[model samples]
Target: MAPWLQLLLLLGLLPGAAPAPNEPRAAGAQAWELASPELLEPARFALEMYNRGRAARTRAALRVVRGRVRRAGRGSLYSLKATLVEPPCNDPTVCQLPVSKKTLLCSFEVLNELGKHMLLRRDCGPVDTKITDDKSETFSSFLPLLNKDPLSQDFSVKMASIFKDFVTTYNRTYDTKEARWRMSVFANNMVRAQKIQALDRGTARYGVTKFSDLTEEEFRTIYLNPLLKEEPGKKMRLAQSIPDLPPPEWDWRSKGAVTKVKDQGMCGSCWAFSVTGNVEGQWFLKRGALLSLSEQELLDCDKVDKACLGGLPSSAYSAIRTLGGLETEDDYSYRGHLQTCSFSAVKAKVYINDSVELSQNEQKLAAWLAKKGPISVAINAFGMQFYRHGISHPLRPLCSPWLIDHAVLLVGYGNRSATPFWAIKNSWGTDWGEEGYYYLHRGSGACGVNIMASSAVVD
Candidate 1:
């Protein structure tokens, strides 16, 4: 065995032998009743949850050997022993291998209540069945990426398993060359994510996201705006002080000031979405009617700022005022690309009086947001590519305030178990981080939350 393989085995990181990190810990068996209909349902529930968390290709068929159930408060606890059998073949055209026949004996405990089944604990050990060395004709071309292991510490085995999971989660299908390159990129990104996770001061979890397969440059060019880092030319007028202090926490979404989370698509139009979200909230609080404003209108009409390429909210506010107010999202729907000026003054629904820059102090920014509305701001977006959830507070050097890239909206501020965070709305749709929102560390000006803060002044 290789030295690295020996080390992995010593660390107990062998493939297929180790339970998933989020799975329940292994425990000894307890006395229980015999197999029953109630117990079978809970066992099936546990199996379903397990399968859902795994890659579609790795899914196994369940054959119950024994089962038992006991009553718990408002739910039932179940114990089950079963065999997990691997599928016969991956492709119908090439069926050279004889079912792979490999299997495992797993002991599972599940809790079921009101149609919700939760797997409590599972302990699985390899069965006597084993796979032959034969490879299918259809699968041989991508053999390096599809190798299976019942229990081994080989790097190839682990890499194959993880890469498969990532592709399945994102529903990605790539040719051989693309798949090889993406696997390399995925490996590199996971390392970066681990570093970010270790350096984070807050409770953020960083790992394989939807963007795991993409290289840093690809992610930046497609999703981030380079123009945000540029200076806004001249400084805008400073915001005035509010009459009352803000509460400890605030969220514009609950108050109906913010619109539904929208996607910016593949364009670098995060700047436009950020500005629109801020203005949307501003218009709602002032006019008492929530309206989804047009981001495409700004993309087409904002002469001072570039469309799809990148733009600044300060210049975008001026553009909104230049276009004789702004039109609704329905009037000028978004196409996620640069287009000719099709904006109409007669279709205008909401207008802004002017815009103001906020103080760099987070306390004051929160105060202004509480009184005004969501604030449009730019962030470094350094660790944002693979950011999953929790209060993301990367190290200052990693996510510097001076060099910002992506634009976002500050919709709310609150605490996550004593770690304060700013709920930021991104333009990447609800399927992304925290339901289209990024919770950044607050109070310390993490990720340039205090830098480049500004908003439209709706009448």
Candidate 2:
């Protein structure tokens, strides 16, 4: 009599309109109508395959919108439409979803035979389909994007979902217009990250990280140091001494020659951090007292290197000598910006006699690092932006070694399942990589890890 009642009757949601999920079926090889409860098993089997193909965060489940099971030669063929629903949160442990949301619609063809089921087809589209469900799981993931690529017709919707997850993870807030623009940028970044992941030769994973939504230009402007090459700066005196054969493994942190990880914020002051890290280790080994040195003092006092725009570790090392020494980080707290040089002689606690460059040979570099504290180095950092963890060994063509744009510290070296690696100390904070560390592949000169290898001499 009522329009709502008519709609429910048409969808087979009425009390006696369809067989209940727990209802017993007739004992004969016959076709199960759309309302038959026996078809739910094949529908669930199809959904499991669908969800398993998606990423953990984006995996979803569904309720049967419409379905039928037809008796065939050996098994029943199930053609089903289900309404997809997202998980309450993107928890990897959670595959459950509230079907009341009525998110997307998916058509799945499953062949159930001999106690096993095979998925024949799956085509999901964004639509709200009325469905009834005893249980449902999460829906939507990057798998569709993987199969479809970035140019898929439904890519806009998929990127929007991923961007929303990124924003939530990073606690980012943007206006409507800016959010839309960022979504576009995030989509493009996903494409780039996919390329990086595909071409990467090492075990390093490239995907949605802290800067997943950032454009390449913005990422470079904020985190990269472009001045390493622009101002070649002074050449350091070459170290004449080479240590004995390096041990199987070495770590300066375990030896207490390294300080806790420090964040450089949004400034291009990695040159200062790299030089200071090397000097800190040198001072600790030579003076027997490890100290966290000031990078802010370098940012302010280094006359040869540009303050925040970019600088070279070699220039920072030279500037430290000319400025009398470096004050402790406590005395010259980091403000992450250019400031008038207020380096007081009274606060200068550590001094460098001079800085010397290390040998370029990988074996020699390892020996030098093992005996003489951590070594300062520069790298191309092309894949560093997307690096999460594991050994990052990008192909030379992907990450050019000549275009060194960032500075870091080499604290140790070791082999993992026969893959030699250099334990690098990055200034991007503890959250960036493996606790502010980047493991680059060794022996192959990956990303110029051996380039710009130098250390301050503490007398």
Candidate 3:
């Protein structure tokens, strides 16, 4: 017989070879085996070395073990009693071999060398298994990393449901162990944030969805970049004297000065939303009817702005002033992308006479919001990305007063627990942050709320 035929017969691949009626099969012989000798030979040799406690002597031997184990599938390997060596080493650099679970013997040095070599491999299946096992051992380990408190069963179930919904809604794909682990971390953070909110310290805030999953860079790019634009050559004064008496607690949403919350999607066109919101409020106050003005108009027609890349509310105001006005959402509609200008002045429903920049004094801002309508403001919204609800006075370290990176509307102000806060409206839709509104620390220039504040005077 040919060597290939002999090998196939040995692997039980040729068929027709059956045991006698009275005879029995080998104790652990598998019905199915790998057809490739190239893979099987190395795997058998590696297993022999592992049994002899010499598997960690070389990198090549370790690679063979990992490859065969992965190719055979994790279930098959586990069934064979292939598990991590006992008494894990303290050092991270040391490797642990998957020895037969029944075997009690272990060699630390061999395991260490094997681990080091395994770490170097691009596709180390054993490392993947380790990560999987670690993830399974802890129910969302990232939760404890954020907060040491034990989570309730209800919270866990809710979080799991939320995670499932998020993955389904976003069409998220976790193709690898690392990806799944990351999703788990995000889910854990979401659950923790919810728990923090449930305590109702009244100061702790929580977000609606898994905003924690987004990195700072991703958040900045998607939600906070709209305010990044070159400033006008002439600096505008930001402070002006106002009455000493505190403004009344006000909410423009109640007064019908604010429109329904809008979403910018992935576009960095928050400048457009801010501009339109301010204009919408001004239009409502002047015309006695609320109108959803076109953010798409500015996104498409504003030559001075960078559309989705970034822009400024002030620049958007300038575009509106030049173009003679903006159309209604029903006419132009928001596409959430850069497109050719489809704006028509004939369809214009609102026009801005001019835009005025406000003083940096929080008191003055509060007064202006009370006296006027919604005003657009640029702010450092780094922490607002995860904001759910509450007085969002983010820690100083999480945000900087000088780094103004987002445009939002100042709708109202009030005192909560003797801590005054600015009622700011966001463009991330009604699902986020207090129905698209957030409260920030009123004074001390929190998150640059008092800086670069402006409002359009509409006709």
Candidate 4:
């Protein structure tokens, strides 16, 4: 026999030799195996690094670890019983892996060193393990990092999958599906914008934004004042009158038996709501009745343009006065609508000593609301979507905090012996805060008083 035939015969006769040349490959060929034994340690390390670097001061630690990962090239370069991704992203790299329970993913990223600055791009692949999905339904979580693609294919598909999972988790965590969906959309857009910025060497501009994003001053200059100039009928103002008594003292206006209304979401009608709330309270004080009134009228009809979605109480009061006084909550109703402003017989309810701060006004207001029902009060500095709930102040020195803007009704006040604090209601809805209410120091006058317009719910 020929030498080649002799060698082939010997190989075929060995224990694992196949009977035929066309035989299928065995399970051993396609079987899944650990990508690397080192995955566990590297993953943990990356997570720790991410947490440490979450703040500005610890960013240097991240840079140092980034350097280490750079040395771990993607190859059969195994060491100490673990497979680690090799760096110099001529291939994929991973960092900042999430803590989850459902799917196990190994992350990789590549960075382009630009002297003192570095551009980071990342990719991740599923590891086929039973783990938690941390990305599920979280509106603000699972944001994809910027992509610096040296290759033609985009990582957008994977990014989107992660985003979807984030939304899923967020929806599960947050009871409000609509709010979660909207936040998801906002987060995704923000991520995309960040990616664009990274791609352009960390410098790019976002185009125009939604009208709601504009500031009160910006809105006035761009829209409100102009509209008022062209359509004078839209501009409403209360005629100045001689005061029966001095303007009510801050303490008097601030004092009230604590109650809160849920914060309505950003609809650019805060002016209307604030003014309406004040009106509602004053009306009740004057006529001894309670009725919800029309906030929608200000939202729809107050076309003065200064503050649509972002309005002020002064403007809403002007609109009411311009339209020859607002009717009782029972007459026009407090539905959120925008009906045509019509002339009404109702006259503005006035509070005597509007600015006078009677002694122990806080105690008086508390007693009044405890006996009556709810009293309205004005707050300042509420300028975010989160205010739609009972938001804890990010800062402290709880002595005198004024994070609330606009005005809200104070229905009742109470305190537990264990927790010597007053409970207050908000208008942002019931799911917010400690069951649609916030607790503050009893005598601090943070929210216990303020002349929210009173109401008269006449038939």
Candidate 5:
């Protein structure tokens, strides 16, 4: 026998040292009582290389057994008996053992110790050993690894069901690259959602249903492109200096100053939505009546601004003012495409005298919002593509303040659990965010919310 093989037999890791297959089993013996003989060659090679100080070769041999153990699952550990020549005891002098029978240590414990030793010795690179643990314990502990709290089995089932529903809901065809991409995105977003929820930052909870499958480009093209234009050289009018007593909390939705959330679909028409939303709030505040204005009017008639290709809310306001006025949604419905001007001064329902740009200071912005109605503003919406809610101020380095690319309606502000937030209404329909709204971390200039704050002057 090879010297390494003899050493393995002494350690009781080989089946040759165990009783014959026909021998009576001991009471409470596990099902995998016999280790497979195939494991001995690699084990002996690994030990031999380790003793020889060939770290690389030792790692290679250990990897072979590790792969087998992983493939065999944790249940196979019971069959792997390790003979401990030096038994673990509080007092070595008090320990006694029969000279004929070797002491068998728990295989799972021995394997774990071996893995730790290999890691400490740099024989193997760092690895998540928990992934190879007992299946039951592994699955139970998987959530924590992802920085999520333990989820109920029903929640897990529901998450799986949501993934299936997303495929059908988005009308995605299965088995294609796009389908596979969507699945990957959905799974990633689910994990992200759970991690966000675990943060307990606010009362909001994130989910993987709505915009999870859409790529950043797709999201920007559909919802954010309208605000992608360079800042126009025209100077914005300034509002009269108002008192600085901001309200404790305010929501235009509660006061009926905000309109129902509208979807831009595949059109880059958020510019029109933002303008119309601001006008809606202004009109409601001035006339004490709500009006659902036409976004299609802007798309068709606003030649100064691009319809679906993308435009700015400031430009949309300019187009509306240039066309003399804007019509109601019932008169000129949203087609989500560019068309020729169908402007009619006779059918115009509302008109803004002018629009004023607010200061970039968040405190001043908040004060203005408390006194005024909803404001049309542009923001850096990079991380907002999969935003599941919870004062969305991403800590990612890529979310720069200079990347302002999306236009939305700043409707209100409030603090939840002492965390202040800006209530902004998006144009991606009522199914997104807190019913078609997102709360941004207030007073931090989060996502460039303080960059381009502006409101229309309704008379």
Candidate 6:
């Protein structure tokens, strides 16, 4: 046996070596509970590597397993597991395979919830692997196939196990219960099914501004610095009229529209880029406008910091609002390539928007606003990294959306079958789902955090 394998077996004897055995037994036991010998060795090796140097590793040595069984497919599922090994020490004399004394079988899964995709793992919490949408459940596994897109349908043994567990547990815990994961699942699906209230394929068109044209230094000055400056109106305040109550019970799994934003590749403008997205919807909700604003404005103009990229939304919001507001994409175009924030990029403000308090229940709030228009909300940004997909549950503390550096907009709300949900707009280009949106439980704060009433915008 490989010395590394021996070390792993020896490490398994440690009292706390593996995840707690009492962890609810992966939700569903009978349906997809079978384990593979093939999975054990590879998974063990990957865990050792992660334990030894998770901070130093480059590529995630793990793979996400997702797929459908096709003709014989039962309910689909998504699973996570470890694969491959990238050791820093290639020379046997200078380095040996990292031992597994402190590693847990599901360590990688913990990292998944932590919001790091490059890291590998074997499984997620019983409820974590379940996707938030129903149509999305068709592709039940998370295993990224060798040649297939991560979003496409395909499966592997380890990944298959993930789906099987999800379905069985969901069936038992939710389906069996009067109301359980069912409500959350339906909420997510409803968001996935929504038609974009404003832009549809028939009317959608390409206009000015993009992330590719600006330099990283430029992106920061124009976009980030203004929000970060110790200036008036830059900081977001808590909702004054928000009622003090227990957190709202919500299921984000119902139907609405969802879409993936095109990857910006390796840019540090995730903060600016995400904020612009929410603001775009805000502008739309307020003025009935559909302008795709310039991310490069922050990339180039507000130079309190580096412009090429790297700044906070607090700064960006401050700069935009104080300068009387930003412009339409057509008025001040972006090059996609980044630069320092420049004076030239500060376009004239089309409108001045304010924030509102939530005095009513989320359902009541939704019903009330349903008649007016869409409202934007803020939620905590877990980490600096931009979220594309695969997240099913809350992995971080629930803070006011206004507090988190990242931002997204709340569009509409509805009941999926009978479960209630809030529809949210996403910036990850449209290929992400039925459209560029996702659903959250009506009060999950999963979409618009710290939501109450949107500060009404009069066009």
TM-score for candidate 1 = 0.67
lDDT of each: 0.74, 0.74, 0.61, 0.36, 0.61, 0.38
Best by TM-score: 1
True lDDT of residue 159, candidate 6: 37
lDDT of 1 at 274: 90
* TM-score for all models, in order of appearance: 0.67, 0.67, 0.62, 0.38, 0.61, 0.41
Residues 1-459 of candidate 4: C-alpha lDDT, one tens digit per residue? 766445434533221223332233322222223344334344334333223312321121111122233331111111111112222112113334432222223332321111111112122233443334443444333233223322222444455455456445434332233333333344444443333222221111331123222333223222221221122222222223322332222221244312235344432344455456555555555565444565655654555533332454445555665555555445554443233455354433322222111222456555544433344444432222222222222112111133333444444454444332334444545554445554443444543233232322223
Ordered from best to worst lDDT, the candidate numbers read 1, 2, 5, 3, 6, 4
Model 4: residues with Cα > 4 Å off, grouped in runs: 1-263, 281-288, 300-307, 312-361, 364-373, 380-404, 418-422, 445-459
CA lDDT, candidate 2, residue 372: 85
Off by over 4 Å in 1: 1-155
Between candidates 2 and 3, name the one with more favorable TM-score: 2
User: Residue-wise lDDT of candidate 2 within 284-371, one digit each (tens)?
Assistant: 9998999999999998888777666678877888888898999999999998767778999888999988988888898999888888
User: Which pairs of residues have clashing backbones in candidate 2?
Assistant: 59-138, 59-139, 60-138, 60-139, 61-137, 61-138
Candidate 1 local lDDT, 312-419, one digit each (tens) = 888888888888888999889988766678888889998999998888888888888888889999888977888888999876756778778999999999898999
Clashes of each: 0, 6, 5, 84, 0, 103
How well does candidate 5 match the true structure in TM-score terms?
Answer: 0.61
State the lDDT of candidate 5 residue by residue for 93-178, as single tens digits.
43342223223221211122112111101122123221231222212222322233365666655555676677567665433223
> What does the lDDT come to for candidate 4?
0.36
In terms of lDDT, model 6 sits at 0.38
